[model samples]
Target: MNTADRVDLVTRYTQEVVTDEELAELLEEDSPSAYIGYAPTGEMHIGHFTTMRKLADFLQAGVDVTVLIADLHAHLDDEKSPFDLLDARSAYYEEAIEGMIEAAGADPDDIDFVRGTEFQLEEEYTLEMYRMAAETTISRTQRAASEVVRESESPNLGGLIYPLMQNLDVKSLDADIAYGGIDQRGIYMLGREILPNHGGESPVCLFAPLLAGLSGGKMSASEESSKVNLTDSPEEVADKINDAYCPMGEAEENGVLEYMEYLVFPILDERGENFVVERPEEYGGDLVYESYDALESDFVNEDLHPADLKGAAGEYVSEGIDPIRERLTEQPELLAEAYPDKYGDE
Candidate 1:
């Protein structure tokens, strides 16, 4: 596929489009690089998968890709990160990141991994980055891109430098596009505005919708109930989806239903309502429909109960994890080392 088609596929999957022929032409004449950034600060959760899948899709469409581990940002965000902890637990977190990426079916060769600090310090980039970071005020930086900063209790120097360094990553890589979640919009906008001052064109930003946790809010790696980690077992995924806050007979404005609409529904191509699990013995098995409208109409009209939908969602979520679970089971040693606390208990 050409660049335009590739952009379309990414936009379809992510619903965030950041490419245009004019912009693409400018990038081609200017820098001609494309990359996807990842903050490896926490266990790679289902939330991470949404972006990783987009990154892979971008690469499949022949875009050059870079996946940053963002270790330095992890430390800057909190003093308690695995890197700061400097214990077995910290190393385990790092390994878990690698394992989770591999389990997610990300191509190892396609990813250009880097530690944030090291990437910043390479050549004159580090010195230049420090200078750029110094020019931007804390208030401007905070207002421009401080989601992570606001999330921190005591935003430190690293928190302030985080966006600057991230912006520097785009300039340093000379990338044509940068991918992040909607939460990173402010920082990404900062990159677009500030990067050109340092002689690099601003990378067009693509923001994927955030996936809510099972209990129905932003998924947090720190909160067990708030996320489905990549390491979760199939049964765990099923149970979580089963108990998820998917309101029945309602539109997707509901967070849980929105998760189903954006993440789950798109994966199926057809509407999820079409695949009906007919319980009647006379029916012999489930009845599948080609149109989502029909299925949704049946659901909203009380023809289908919420439990039936949950059952289907549980099965679907379970099946989705089958391959990932197989990879995890095959790497028992890796799992033992990466998740010693959880795996050891079992």
Candidate 2:
């Protein structure tokens, strides 16, 4: 696919552009294009879907894609200290990646799952990684990656090397673009500078909006209330949505309701006149929006009832996720067995 097509996918997820001219040049170049990936470090959280969907969009556009299962980085970003062996963590990370790939309907065969430690040891990758670490300052790296690092309990040597490894992945993959969450903007910038020094071109960084957790802050696997896992049953999904803290006329602050505005609404808007995905006739929802103004008018006026909105949002989540969830069920034993203490039974 050309740069414009790649840009479209990025816009759909991130709603912004980093570099227009460079993207166009890459598109014009006759070389095949691919996207770089990071490992599924923890439980496959809602935030990961942004990158996954970006990959799907790229695949649909016929771009070559490389997915690196960053087994090494998982240790750095893991919500806890690494075990002495590291094998268990790696195994879990791989399972999460497999489950995620299956859930997304992405072809496992088409992707490359590189363990981060193995990639790090390669002489070429090692040289590139250090080269990036040298060129970028501690301050810049910290600034770009503050969200993850700041939240980390043990920001040690592994954490510092984590960013460099990410930058090198793009160089080693020789990808035309990189996909990540908005949170990874720092790593992408570091890659922009570090990769070029290692004789690789800078890639256009595309990001997706972070989905809100059920409890309202950014969706995190750490907080069960904040997210509905892909493994969640239909009843579980519905219960979470029903319990969603959507105050009337305040969808922005409420995470579950905001998902309807952010993720579901954009997809609905793209459908033009017959956006039944958000406004199913079953709920008296038939949004006729020729422009953003009309849609905003309806939303601000509360023309869309909260129940219909929530129900439609629930329906969208249920329907859109069925295929992926089915893929997840195939590996029941692999899911995170521990639920949040409160909702463990559900």
Candidate 3:
């Protein structure tokens, strides 16, 4: 693809890019590396889907994709995943990511997956970490890490070192573009500043939007009602979406509409399907949306009722998540072990 086409693809579902010029320059290179790292701390939900869908765009745009299962990062930041359970959590994360890639209509084999422990402890990487610590102040490090990590007034030294290591990861991975949700912006900006000091180029950054939870706030894995887990039963999904907070004729902060825009519409567009809002004939019959914009327009115009939108969203999202749910079903122990408190009975 040409630069413009590549730029469109890379920025398709993203909320922001560090610099359009930098991204355009990256596309000119032959298979420039792009990577996103995820700490294995929680169950992968629709929020993860919204972010990971950007990978499909990158792959199609000819950018090399790398997924970092940042197990050590999790341990470093407040020890979110306990030391013993890190392995299980990482395993579950990788499996879930691969399933998401396939569900997004992208070839999972085209992407590279790496665990932090694979090379993070190496002599060279550790040396760089120490170097960064010397130059970066404690306050700056903590500030850079604040949004990406759990904040504590009496924060541990590990949290202080977390942001520095993250900046180094862009260098160690040899990525041309650092990809993640907007919450990682602080860390990536720090990387652009310090990477040159470590013999690495300034990276182009791409950030996807952080999806709102079904309950009208940020999704939390600890709260089952906040978002739909990939392992949720069909009945469970329907119930959650049905009860979700989607105000009539208002798109702002409407999690149901956000799902349709971010997840349902993209999947439908890919599959050559329409967004069908089923309704009885007497109630103006079923409405079909050729695109998300069309659906949103109708929704804003009050042509679509909240109940119908929620019902349609539940069905469409369930279809999109079906394959991943099936894959997880085969390995019940993965979820059962990774999050025993939530899925142990499975």
Candidate 4:
């Protein structure tokens, strides 16, 4: 692909790119690499699936990709993933991510996967950590990680060091681009500022938009009703999508529409298929949409009912996640070990 096409692919559907100039220059290289980190603290959900879908775009543009399973970072973030369960959770995360990539119509073999403990505990990495700590203030560190780490009136020392390790990770991983959700902007911006002093260059940052919750607000991990789990059965997925916040002739804060725009349409497009919303003969039968824009236009004009949109979205969403659910089901022990309290009995 040409430079302009590559740039479009990289920036498409993203919330923001740190600098368009830097991204253009980086894409000019024979082989450019980008990395995104995810701490395996909770079950892989549909929200995470949306972010993973972007990797297909990077691969299509010929950009090499790396996924960082930040096990240590998970523990430091208020001990969300207990130290003893880190290995199990990390294993589950890697498999789930691979499944997501394949479901998005991309080959998982093209990407490299790295674990935090693989190099974070080394002597050289440890020395740099100390140097960064000496140069950074507690207040600065807290500010950088405020949106990411759990907030406490008296934060633990581990929380303070979390951002430092993240900064160092860019250098250690040798990434040309640091990709994540927009909530990570603060920590990455801090890395761009201070990484140079620690012998690393500022990376091109790519941030994805966060999807709204099905229940009507920000998607939260603690609230089961907010997001659909990766392992949810097709019936469960349909029920959740049926109960999602979708209003007739209105699109604002509609999770069902967001899922169609972000997840369903993209996956279907990749597979060379159209989105089909089935209806009875009296309701004008089935409606086929080759693009999300056309579908949204019909809905806004009141030509389509909210019930029809929700029913279609649920089917497509369920279809997209079926492969992931099947893969995880083959290894029940993975989930049982990773989250014994929740999946042990099952």
Candidate 5:
């Protein structure tokens, strides 16, 4: 692909790129690497799948992709996944991520999966962390990790080190681009500022847009109905989307439309499939969209009803998630062990 084509591939579905100039420069190189780290904590939902779609984009653009299962970070971040459950959760996360990659129409075998403990314990990495610690003030570290680590009056020291380790991960992994949701912009910006001092190059950052929750506002695992779980059944997905806060002809804060644009449409388009909104003869017949923009335009023009859009979105999302749900079902023991309290009854 030419530079423009390659740049389009990388920046197509992303919310922001650190610098288009830097991305263009990297595209000029023979090979550039991109990496994203996920702390193995909660269920990998449809929101997380959106980032996987970007990973597929990078792969198609000829960038080497690395998936970092940050188990240790999960351990250090107030033990969110629990030390004992880290291995199970990490294993589950890898499988789910691979499923997501495939759902995005990318080959999972082409991607590399790395565990945090693999090299985070190496003396070279540890020494650099100490160097950053010596140079970085506690206040600065807290500021960088503000969005990530939980804040409190007596926050654990691990909270401060979390962002530092994440910063170093780019250098340690030798990645050219740091890909993540926009929330990590703060930490990666700090990484760009700090890494050069330790002889590490600042990574070009690519960010995916955060999708709104079904009920509106941010999507969180804590709010069960707020996000669609990878394992959600067809009925559950339909129910969630149907009851979701989607307004007629209003694009703002519509999670159903967000999924249709970010997750469902991209995957469907890549697979040479059409997005069909089924309706009876009375309700303007079935609206078929070969592109998401068409669907969005119709909705924005008030030609499409919210109910019709929700039904279509649920069906498309379920089709995309079916394989993932089946894959996870084959390994019941993984979820059972990882989230014992939640899945033990099953």
Candidate 6:
């Protein structure tokens, strides 16, 4: 691919790129690398899958990709993943991420995976953390991590140290691009400002749009109905999609439509398939769409019913995730050990 095509591949489907100029320049090089970190805290869900799908774009553009399984950061963020369970959760996370990468049509072998403990505990990394702590104020650290870490009137010291480690990670990982959800904008922006002082250059940041909850608002981990778990059965997937917040003739804040745009359509395009919305012959038969925009246009024009869209989305999503579900289910011990309280009995 040419420079412009590579740039388009990286920039398309992203909410924002910190600096387009930097991305263009970086693509001119023979190889440029990008890194994204995911703390192994919760069960992998469709929301996580959507973000993982974008990595396929980066890989296709010939960018080197690294995934950080931030196990230590997981515990530091309000102990969401207990220290004892970190190993299990991290293992599960790697497997799930590999599955996500493959499901999104990218080779997992092409990406490098790193664990936080691999370097974060080293002497040099520790000294740098202390130096960053000395240079950064408590309030600044708090603000950078506010959206990501749990909040409290009286937060723990670990929460304060979280963002500092994240800033230092860019340098340690040797990443040219820092890719994550838009919610991570604050932390990455802080990294841009502080990394130079710590002997690291500002990374080209890529932020993906957060998918709205299936029920209508922000996707919440506490609310099972708001998101689809990777392990959810096909019947469960259909039921959740059927109960999703998709309104007829309206596409805004519609999770079903967003799912089709971000997840289903991209995967279909990769497989050289069209999104088929099945309907009875009397209701104008099955509608085939090769692009998400065309489907959205028909929906907004009231030619495509919400029910039809939801039905197709459910099937596509289920089919896409079935391999992952089956793979993880076979290794029941992974989930059981990672989330004992929830999956132990199953």
lDDT of 5: 0.92
RMSD of model 4, in Å? 1.1
lDDT of 2 by residue, 1-346 (tens): 5567755654565644567677665556554466655554445654564456556556656667777766667666543424332454455455555555555556656666666666677887787677667777766776667766544454566667777777777777778888766777877887787676678888887766677777776677677777766667777777788777766666576676556545455445544432342556776747544443454456667876666556656776765556657765675544433222333244
**Which of candidates 2 and 6 reaches a greater lDDT?**
6
Global fold similarity of model 1 (TM-score): 0.81
In candidate 2, stretches whose alpha carbon ends up further than 4 angstroms from where it belongs are 1-6, 30-32, 78-108, 134-136, 150-154, 261-297, 336-346
Best by TM-score: 6
Q: Clashes in candidate 1: how many?
A: 1
Query: Over 4 Å off in model 1, which ranges?
Result: 2-4, 18-32, 84-107, 150-154, 252-259, 265-278, 281-304, 332-346
Q: Which ten-residue region of model 4 has the weakest summed lDDT?
A: 217-226
lDDT of 1 by residue, 1-346 (tens): 5556655655655655455653445333422345655554444566665566566565555666666656666666654355633333334444544444454455656566555565665778878777886788888777765665545555677777778888888877767778778778888888877887888887777778777666765666677866666667767776776777657676443334444454455445522344445566653456564444555676677665666666776665555445655655676665455445657555
Reference-based TM-score of each model: 0.81, 0.80, 0.98, 0.98, 0.98, 0.98
Model 3: how far residue 331 lies from native, Å? 0.5
| Each model's total of backbone clashes | 1, 2, 0, 0, 0, 0
Higher-scoring candidate on lDDT, 1 or 3: 3
Query: Clash pairs of candidate 2?
Result: 144-186, 214-226
Clashes of 5: 0
Give me the runs in candidate 5 sitting further than 4 Å from their true place.
none
* Rank ordering of all candidates by lDDT, starting from the highest: 6, 4, 5, 3, 2, 1
Q: What is the C-alpha RMSD of each candidate to the true structure, in Å?
A: 4.1, 4.4, 1.1, 1.1, 1.0, 0.9
Model 3 global lDDT (CA atoms, 0 to 1): 0.89
- Candidate lDDT scores, in order, read 0.61, 0.62, 0.89, 0.93, 0.92, 0.94
Predict model 1's lDDT versus the native.
0.61
Candidate 3 lDDT, 1-346, residue by residue in tens: 7889989888887889999988887798879989999999978898898888889988998889999999999898888889989999999999999999999999999999999999999999999999999999988887788888889789988888889888888999999999998999999999999999889989999888877777888866677887988878888999999999888898888888889888988888788989888999999999999999999999999999999998888888888899999998899899988989878875
- Candidate 5 per-residue lDDT, tens place, 1-346, comes to 9989999989987899998999999999877999999999988899999999998889889999999999999988877888999999999999999999998889999999999999999999999999999999999988888877878999998998999999999999999999999988989999999999987998999999898999988877689889999999999999999999988888898888889889988888788989999999987799999988998999999999999988888888998999999999999999998999989789
Model 2 earns a TM-score of 0.80
> What digit string (tens of lDDT, one per residue) describes model 4 on residues 1-346?
9999999998988999999999999999978999999999999999999999999999999999999999999999999999999999999999999999999889999999999999999999999999999999999999999989998999989999999999899999999999999889999999999999998999999999889999987889988877889999988988998888888888888888889888998888888999998999998999999999999999999988989988888888989999999999999999999999999999
